[model samples]
Target: MMFDKVIAAVDKKLERFDPIWQAENGVGGQRDRYYDKTGVAKWREWRGVKDTMVDYGAWLKNLASMAMMVASAPIPCLKGFWEYRWMGSYLGTFMFIDRLFEGFRGYELVTAHKCMHAIVRSLTKKIAFCLSNDRRLGGGKDTDRIVPMDEVLPPLFMMGFKELVPFPLQTLPEFIICDVDQHIEPYYIDVAESFGLPADVCSRCAAETGVALDDAFPLIGKAMISTNMPCNASEATSMFQRRRIGMPDFPVTLAMIHNEPGAHPYSTQMLKDAIAFVEKEYGVKYDWDNLFKYAKLMNEQNTIELEKWDYFKTPYSALCGIAETLYRLYAWASVNGTDPYFNKVDRQVIKIMRKAYEEKKEPFGGRTRHRAFLWGPSAVYYTDFPTWIQNCWGINIVLNMDSTMGHNMINTEDPDEAIKDLALFSEKATMRHHAVGGWDNVNAIWEWAKNFNCDMVLMNDNIACKGMLGVHALMEEQARDLGFHFIFIEHDLEDCRTVSRQDMRNCVNGYMSVVLGEEPLDPTLVEFDDSDAY
Candidate 1:
């Protein structure tokens, strides 16, 4: 049921200090000896002697020893030596980078630890990879040694740590449940049971109760029973079979596109249409232009040049962009789906919002900020990829998708097939999905969304097939009770070019209007019409 073994391993080792930690905290005071005039002179002389050497191995060894000393030194002393604000901070940065690179490369912890030793070795290696490749360095004869720690560290750290931590843990929970709803009650109960907790104790109990159930007691009872005991003996045996053989063959009817890089004009239009529909239906006035302006400002602040909205250039920047996009997408979906739940769960939120706004009373009867207490669809989830690049650079673009619709989509469907489509989109920009039984596999997604407080679920309605649409309708109804903002955008997985510039603007603007309570702006003003542009 749970990755208990992995959790146990992490829990056990989490408390133990690595060499870096021990060196920083325990041996941080040894830097004075190195800082002394004599010590400085000795190091300088060593550097001078090393610079004159033609032997690469000797140079490498010397650097390795120095790096080892630096890595193993007390955190405070290391800081003073580097004249940085904090020694521990510097070591922490290096260790983080080392771990991240290791994770990105899919190295196990032990393997990563060993690789850290190798990096330390390379730190000492005088021949830089960059220098090795430089024609100006006179091919292999160049003796110049340099360390571009900054350039190398970020990608390594960014990629490695994400890999080390399974995608599910880092991003799940958040995206699975955008807003709470009735249809997802069973899923919530199951999750609670998995954690050995009572369903009543689950965070979204309020929403789950909306479902027509014979008795709430059974929910708690089932969870309690499942907690301390395994399933029946036959079921346990079946579990093994399930683990080894997986489910029966099911045709994939839906294609999930991953990392669909091109302009998202359709997404933009969908958002606009959704906003217009919601506003007209709900009688809510919004400021769409202002919202888009804010989005543009945010994009600029994050250094995402609208002119260069092609493939994500850097990992960090890519993550930032993805996070922004997913956040807005989720917001739009939740808002558009609000009509379904308008008389049900959403009214409760509105009541809360009004009370907080006018009466200054908290919603959910909590003392948190008014904004914090205003609940909607929100959860965290994770995604997986085959290659390290997909895992690192590509996946990060939607790091917060779990907190968005991405999590819900995966949970509701065959994750393998969904992932396959996602990957295809990343590589070739195409996707397809096969059905499982009568369900759309997106049930998992809906369940997760309900857990998170999503009343309306947002999904990528690429094909709009009957089965998939049925799933959406069911989710929409459930969201009405749970109070979701449901919305879906259409686009082909294969055609990255299908996402036009206008679509991107409309999507961003419309989503912002819904989430931020603004108007839907005209996408025509955004100038996304250029077809030849990236």
Candidate 2:
């Protein structure tokens, strides 16, 4: 009971300081904005709902959310206190952390599940990526087959499997968006280095290579599905793993379009064969009717997405586009195809935007000075850049490559036809649409920008994806040719060491000030200092 005089003295001093913050107008509490008696009851109601969830993990998630919500209550009343005005950034960080760790506590994580096929580690990276991410991004219930760039995967479900996972990778959008890859991947990269992986190989691939080489990713799923899209990192992983890590052999079904005449049919047959492979291997039965069910749902989602994209095209939101763009990339192609979440969110989005469209309102609320579109991969490494731009110098990213909803409509008139249609539809997903070389290759970028009324092109060069890097100059020239300014920054979508976050900010700020002729709020970021340490 004998407390030190020093403690007593500090406690008295602390109470005096605390009163200032707790003085009704202080940062001590924001309960007035978030809760009245009714609101408190509402929170309890949600707490009760969470109590009914079958999974214990829901409890942890709910508690975390509750903490975040409470922590954010002051945000609405931020103007009441100058010190609390930057609540958006703090709340944003919490949301980012929550999104990053969504499924880790729920199911036997996608990375931990067991699979029974010979996965070319190259192809399986997409599989592994989607499996781990499907639950969080798409609201997808299960992972049945790994389908790349196809809205037509209900066929596999029809065969008997519960869920079919789709890979929309040209760049790993999910991992990049999560940015937690930076935490888990560095160790894996070290493992790859120890295993004698090449230095010049893209860090994205190299990091995934680290995952396989260390046997860190749990081998799960019935079979591996991939397309012949030249993802060098995946190839490097597969080729190198064969020489080293000795991953369990699994059957790989490579879905490709060798002939334009029979391409649809070929994709359909390949998918059907893949269904057979999984049924034979995983012992899961496929339900043919699910094909039509998912097909209808996906079609509905596509329409909603188009409507949402129309809202995006308008200047309405003051939000930094990068974080929003990342979520859209996850939601639009991947999750929208899987569940009703996207449609529900789209309805809310449309509601908010309808007023804007009708009133002829600017989405950025006059904050946007530059209307930009992202090229190549996004800067997942410095995801805050978009927000920084918004806070520092109001730039609106009107469109992200992943957010493009072009040509995703699939015919559900016939499920069999839907199979081919959706399979091919998925083939045209974000990175795949442009990454797969042909007439539309780089030209597609121009075509998309022409529609969006973009003011400038912000290319986030993921140094890891060299294929796109090879044509960097051509795309930049095209952007200029379109009479729009082009600014390219060399930054990885995943790894941070290549270009530190502040430097990435500096590069973007420099471009904004110099090339775009916009004054930056933090002009210090516009300078280039090569001597700076990563």
Candidate 3:
């Protein structure tokens, strides 16, 4: 009885530090949950009893997915863990997920988990598939059935090859893993530098080159397809990768300034040539029926995506932040209508979004002080920046530049028309259109912000992105003229070693506190050490 009373007394005294209580009052001491300088929280965040149960259930679901990954190919997965450095980095996934949706509740909580679990389930399956067939891990029966392709290329069009699995090769070793564990890529980057690659190259490109040089990528596919869609750096890295992999590779160079009508024919022909190359190498005919089946799925997914954008323009979107961007990036680029599961997830999420809108419930319990459009490529290392900003400040990230990738509806019938549509869609791939396609595309940020009804633009200034380097003054001047609140959050894209997560937060902290003269909703988040954290 005395112990119970003592516990109650202490809880009452420390109510200010209780995340659940602080959440209700709109001034959370969220930092109290963490041990200093680490991602480790002393306890799981206490959403109210109901939401807590939901969160715990979601955690269990993810655990099950991880277990299945190991079970699918026990020996291969074991070998993969031992042979691949990036595979071990996946151990931080649960922690990374925990941090992704820290302050979520009610509809947002449920919606985020639905979207996240879809990715989680899909990723685990992909990991198993890769490990099982990986030639590097003692090639299985299905090794030659894989068609390794550039991660940036939308693999949707590759569905025409019904017999083969078109895998985004770099996604396993470099891209997605970087989002989970920030420290993993730095070693690869160092490997590339040691191999005579300059240190000043884009970290994304450098890390990919390093992954190639380190021979960490799974050996799969009879022939590989590389692309020059996103940038020159990516093209350069493709050369390095092609040499390292020693595979018969075809480079699909899409037109850079792709918006012009003239560029379509060139890009379409390139796609046709690439398809021909694949058909010749793999000895499999292209099947339009197979392509159309997946095309319809992509079309419906995109239609729902457009409808979701309408909700984003309103103040009542159930989905926002990393939950919105990360899912779109993965679904659009990686999965790309290849799976029916994502479409089902999207349907469920949209229903919840509609209900939330109908109820007029805003995310973060209506504490949103600014509805901002996050422009430029966000830091992969700090994927939860959106969640952090919402919890620490009242700024709701309404949209992200990456999410604005190719939404054009493809023709569900007619092979010729569909090929053209695919080319057009592929032209606007992630970071390709906005970051490096042309000056007009880069300058379209203001129009996008206005269309989305955003009051502020949080421009991600990737310090080493050569494409965006010279636009700093122009963007600032334009923001001033347009009368929208803008702040440039600078970070080295894939390399947190250059600009730490704290440095990125400090960028927003200075702008929020000094310029806006607004105090943080959770002041404890303003300055903290997560440098040593996963």
Candidate 4:
């Protein structure tokens, strides 16, 4: 009782330091809650009594998910922790969840937590299964049943092999962990460079190469399916992976410059060949019935997703910022219509979004001053940039480059027609469709911005990406010609050590304060050191 009373008094004192409270009382500093140079908050954010309970409940759910993962495979989980460097970084998952939705409340908070918990539950199960079956950890029965593939390759078609698991090899070791802990990727990036791989290559590719060289990727599959996708940089990384993995491998090189009508046939045939290779290696049949079932689920998710976009154009969208983007990135890329749970989540989210729109309930209590269309791959380390912008400045990111991936509907009845439809969809995967598909695809940002009714563009400039380097001048000139406020936030993709989080924040701070001549809604967030933050 005494402890609770003390905490309440401290929280009340801290409330006066909050900008909203300061506006009324005229006392205290908001940034006092944190120790200098670190993200360790001295106290939890006080969001009144009700919202704090809701936030705490969601945090507990995530903790339970992690506990269940370890309980399901205790020995293997322990072995994984001992064997893998990346396992230690997953401890920051709770902190990552807390930081991502820092200022959120009400329906937006509920929606964000629901979407995030689904990801957490799914990823935890995946980690447990991968660790149990990992040959490096004394291979369980399902080891041969796992089919390791490039993380960028859409796993929807792999559902046709009913008996096998389609595992994204790099996700466990490198991709997802980088988002949780910024410090994790640099070690791998350094490993790649020290191995005589050039330092100028894309950090994403370099990190994967480093993972391969360090032998961190789990040995879980009979054969590996590699791809020349997202970009040419991945081709070399895939090669390094194949060599280190030492498995029978199939190269699925889909068409680049894929906007033309002629590209579908080539990409479609490649998908077929990939299927044939898998069948031959695994001694499994391509079950058309199985693939069709997932296709219908995929179709439903895409249909609902399109409906959600209509609400995004209005002021009443309950889902905006990082909650919308991060969920879509994982659901569309990682789950890809194969999981029934995501389809369920999609249906539930859309219903909430529709009700919010009908009631005219706006996100962030309608504080949005500008609607921006975010283009290019976002910095994985600073994944909550969208959330920070809306809290500090009133910029609502209506859409991100990754969220716009692969929405085409798949035909369920016919095999021949379905593969072709899938080709059209797969070609649009993440960076493959927009960043490197061609100049026409790259230039189509104007049309997208217009459709979404965005007044500004916050373009990500990943310094090491060779493909996007040449388009800077053209994009800047076009932004001016089209009469839009534009800013380039620069970072080295996954490597936070190179650009640092503060540098990225200053990009917006300078633009908002100097260029637009605007003051921050929360001055506490305008400039703080999260350089030591997880």
Considering every candidate listed, which one attains the maximal lDDT? 3
lDDT of 1: 0.26
- List model 1 lDDT by residue over 1-534, tens digit each: 356576546544632222222222443211121233111211211111122132223334435655655454334233333331112222232322221221121111222223233333433221132223222223332211111111101111111111111011001111122111112333434543464543222222222221112111101100000000011221232232223232221111121221233323332332234334434433444443333332333223223222112221211121122223323333222221112221232223233333334443321122111110011112211111111111111212212222222211111133333333222221211011121123433444445443333333345443312334456567657656656454444422112233332353344345445664543121112222322211
In candidate 3, stretches whose alpha carbon ends up further than 4 angstroms from where it belongs are: 1-20, 23-28, 376-383
lDDT at 519 for candidate 3? 83
lDDT, candidate 3, 1-534, per-residue tens: 986687567657766655746755777577778888888899988765556778999999999999999998899999999999999999999999999998898899999999999999999999999999999888989899899999999999999999999999999998898888888989999999999999888899999999999999999989999999699889999999999999999999999998899999999999999999999999999999999999999998899999999999999999998899888988899989999999999999999999999999998888889988987464833547988888888888888888888899888789999999999999999898788888899889899899999999998898888888888899899999999999999888888989999999999999999999998888778899988777
Q: What are the lDDT scores of the predictions, listed in order?
A: 0.26, 0.47, 0.89, 0.86
Alpha-carbon TM-score of each model against the true structure? 0.23, 0.65, 0.96, 0.95
lDDT of 2 by residue, 401-491 (tens): 7665334566655657666765566445545555543435556676676677777777777676766767777876787677877777777
Question: How close to the true structure is residue 372 of candidate 2, measured as C-alpha lDDT?
Answer: 78
Query: On a 0 to 1 TM-score scale, where does candidate 4 land against the true structure?
Result: 0.95
Candidate 1 vs 2: which has more lDDT: 2
Q: What lDDT does model 4 reach? A: 0.86
Rank ordering of all candidates by lDDT, starting from the highest: 3, 4, 2, 1
Query: Any runs in candidate 4 off by more than 4 Å, and if so which?
Result: 1-31, 376-383
lDDT score for candidate 3 against the true structure = 0.89
Q: How many collisions per candidate?
A: 87, 27, 0, 0
Stronger candidate by lDDT (3 vs 4):
3
